[model samples]
Target: MKSKSIGLSPKSFYYGYDSKKDLKHLVRLVLILVFIALLTGMIGIWVVYRSAHERHLDMLRAFANTQGDVLDAYMLLDEVKSGRVHGDTPHEHNLDNVKELLLKQESFLETGQLLLAYEDTSTGKYILIGTGHMPSGQHSVLVVENTRELTPSMRLALEGKEGVLEGQDLHGAPVVTAYLPISKHNAGLVVMLNQSEFYAPYHRARLITLGIGVVFVVFGTWVIWSAEQKNLRQVREREQLIRLSFENSAIGKALVAPDGSWLRANKSLVNILGYTEDELLRMDFQSITYPEDLEADLDHVQAMLKGEINVYHMDKRYFHKSGDIIWSHLSVSLVRDEQGEPKFFISQIQDITERKRVEFENQRLHERLMDQLSLRRQQLDTASGALEGFAYSVSHDLRAPLRAMSGFSQALQEEYGDKLDDTASDYIRRIHRASTNMAELIDSILRLSRTSFGELNVVSLDITAMSKRVVENCRVVEPDYPVEVRVAPGLKGQGDLRLIGSVLDNLIGNAWKYTHGVENPLIEVGQEHVTLSEQSDDSVLAFYVRDNGVGFDMAYSNKLFRPFQRIHSDREFEGSGVGLASAQTIINRHGGQIWAQGQTGKGATFYFTLNHTQFDSEKNSTS
Candidate 1:
């Protein structure tokens, strides 16, 4: 029997083998494509997430810096007004008002909180002196009484480091905090916002990116498995989307080749340079860079390529297509391949021409202001010198004639007492008295002039000792008057010794002279610790001279320090009315203040402070 169907077609056998091999190859291709898609999606997600996080952090930092600047301005204003003549006790009251105003002004920021805090040197704990927003359920407006344990941010601020911190707030909510020191006051201002609120936009972006990435991965897998030609088309579409995203960005963006040529540039970049995209792509970055800035940019690029730095940012000038100079803030980062080799550079740029212009205008205005101030100062100096010369002339020329008139009148009275009639003798006596009074007035004017122009020599002074010397001198002058003086021991001050001594003599002598006939006459000199608006600590010394003397009406208190203005007649109080005026001039020259408080026949008190304790040499120099 013939073998049953032993013969086979060669074409059929070959077709079966070819089908198996093609199926195997297709399976391998699909697996490889899926793996690549998954990896690419994960990397894209990570990159997007990291970028979003960094951007959020940058925004928070900027906000914090702005808040710090505002707080610093308030502090500076407070310092300027600290030693002003407000006529209030314990200058801290004025500071409280300023703090309240700051809080009211800043409370409009609903999303964040602003606070002024100080660390108690004795307790080493932080105290919140002012707050824009009270914590939940807290009703007290003054938070200074409530001290809290120090936070890391507070510690850093007190240590003079301005920075940002992420941690829980007093209410135990996660927050981002920025703090800076109040340099003049030994305090800190903290700005804080809820972390969740700050990151809300990033969260939304992350979710959107995740969904889009998932869709693209699924669609990509299907396209790859269905047809190779379709896969290529899908890839082209993805690249187009990426390009669209790059071009539509709000900030200028560009891709630069390793050779410094711009491989691709977005519309924003083209607009910034006033050039077309095609034109920019053909030009290298060095060609458009300002000559002064090109060298630094090259150095930065070289550093990035050498892996010495990952990114660099600078403010640079670039030449526009029209050859005009344009200022821009540039940020660049190097992109690397999988093998960690430099591939290209990604650059982001922002136009800062308007900011630069504003800064230049401000500088010009400042220079003009300084020049005007200098000219005004010169004018004042000229006027002051002329006045001083006139005063000197009056003191010298007028005093001699007055003295001669008085001496001749006295001689006439002594020699011709028997020959002259009673009326003539009375007239001579009047002439003598008038000339003496005029002499006293001229002397008072001279003292006033000196106080205004005298140079000061600042030094530590034992005020108690100085007061004792003044009291002793007053006793020698009025040995008949019965007076009891009390001076506090260890009373110290910082000021010009000679001027302060003169101040004490006038104040104490006035006190002694005013209490003419009262029983148990007393004068007390002492210092009290007071707070100033500019300083956090209560270290200022307010010296006062208290006396149970013949005090005047409060209504005329404003005229007490005016030259030649007296509340009492010469008959009641023998004075030229220049003592207080001279004292005021001296105190003002020292950057101090003087004020009087009294009532009719009850008593009088004079308070003054040597402001050198509160103000530095620079401020005192101007004053």
Candidate 2:
């Protein structure tokens, strides 16, 4: 005969046809659990209720203190109206007014007394008007709601000695009390309270706890019994089942020697090492585990033994019966004895070789895809370089001959005017002007196309000095205006220098042109650090060329950066409408962006950002 334990818990195991023992054990376990839970819950309930009542008592105390001050005013009135009225002093006019005020606040005094605990020793009326003379050379105060209960210690208080005493009042209450003696002007006050009120909540709490404890035991037993029946549902009652439950339970069900030898394992665990059930029972977990995984598993098992982590899952390779490596997801837990120290290891294993293979394939594919993407980007940059070469040739070579043709045609008209009629002369002048304009248009397009290229020589360039040079060129173009220029220092930026310089030329030149209408114009070139969004992680310097000049309408700001887009006519401000487009292309080439803001009659400011990585690269390249 074999004996084993069984309850609702997996921690329990049934042995050798003892259904009666199994059911009994289950009932006992649930009862114990329910009892513990009831104990904790009842204690919590008691604390919460006690805290609530304590707060109520505090509110009571605060109300009493507030009321005492109100009653004190009435006492002051009494002192004034009845001031030493022993055939000596008359009631003053101020005293009469105070007496009236006291009558006015009588209702408030009545409501106040309702919250306080008191007994008047003078007349045995707890709320009657009583007297206490202020020891500060003032008349005696009329006291209300004063305690009158005199214990053995306090009854003697009127007889002239002062001491703390505990005794029953006229109401037969066992109370704690205090007495203050007043020999002068024949007056005294007694303070008392029944001690039972403070302990009432605690006594009620204990009673509730006892009731819950009994109920818990009964309910817990029923739950545990039901749970046991549910567990037995899949267990077919047969001789083999009775044997197999003890022999082949899934969690490495085993009985082992003190030396850690295996005594048993289930069919599920037998497959873990590609061995038969009989073959595995002779081998411990350490015998099959690879040397590399053995130490880690043992350390984890030690931690489980010390109750650090209750259960641990590990992926480890083990030598099977045929010396083949088999990967398993091993879960080790303790099989405890009656005294609860670990007696044997119950190691659960799940073969996961297929899953590992899939993961390795996915990781390799990801690396391949990343390499392909990088190669594709390099190819695209190379292609964009070839396009830039074609554009530069088209702009420089094609436009040079066009400019010469425009100059010769204009010279032919001026030098050979007598050889032509009015219609022919006008036609030649128009042809020359058209050719010059086309040359300017081609120049603008080439500038825009070159900036659009992907190949960029990014570096930190002094934008302050760059702006000053652009202003100097603007001055050479328009020396009559005598325009002012202000460039910010510490205004270095990260970008392709040639492209960024083109952007400054367009922006600062636009500012200078717009301000030409002003008799004395002011142009400001400045940069300030800023964040585009209030909560954005990106931070950058906001560089702007602002001018005190004629500005465009607010509505047309969106068209400013668009290619071949213009807000003003060529006649008003002679431009190809491609300057802003060229500027945007340059900024975009350096991984930055440009935008303009202006109001009707207010100056325009252009702002943009470069990446922090670009700034660091610029610093390194310069050094």
Q: Give stretches of model 2 more than 4 Å off.
A: 1-379, 400-417, 529-541, 612-623
The lDDT of each candidate is: 0.76, 0.63
> What's the TM for model 2?
0.45
User: How well is each residue in 258-292 modelled by candidate 1, as lDDT tens digits?
Assistant: 66777667788888999887788667888999999
| Model 2 clash number | 6
TM-score of each: 0.58, 0.45
Candidate 2 lDDT over residue span 63-102, tens digit each: 4345444445554556556674343322233233433443
* C-alpha RMSD between model 2 and the true structure: 35.0
Predicted structure with the largest lDDT when compared to the true one: 1
Q: Clashing pairs in model 1?
A: none
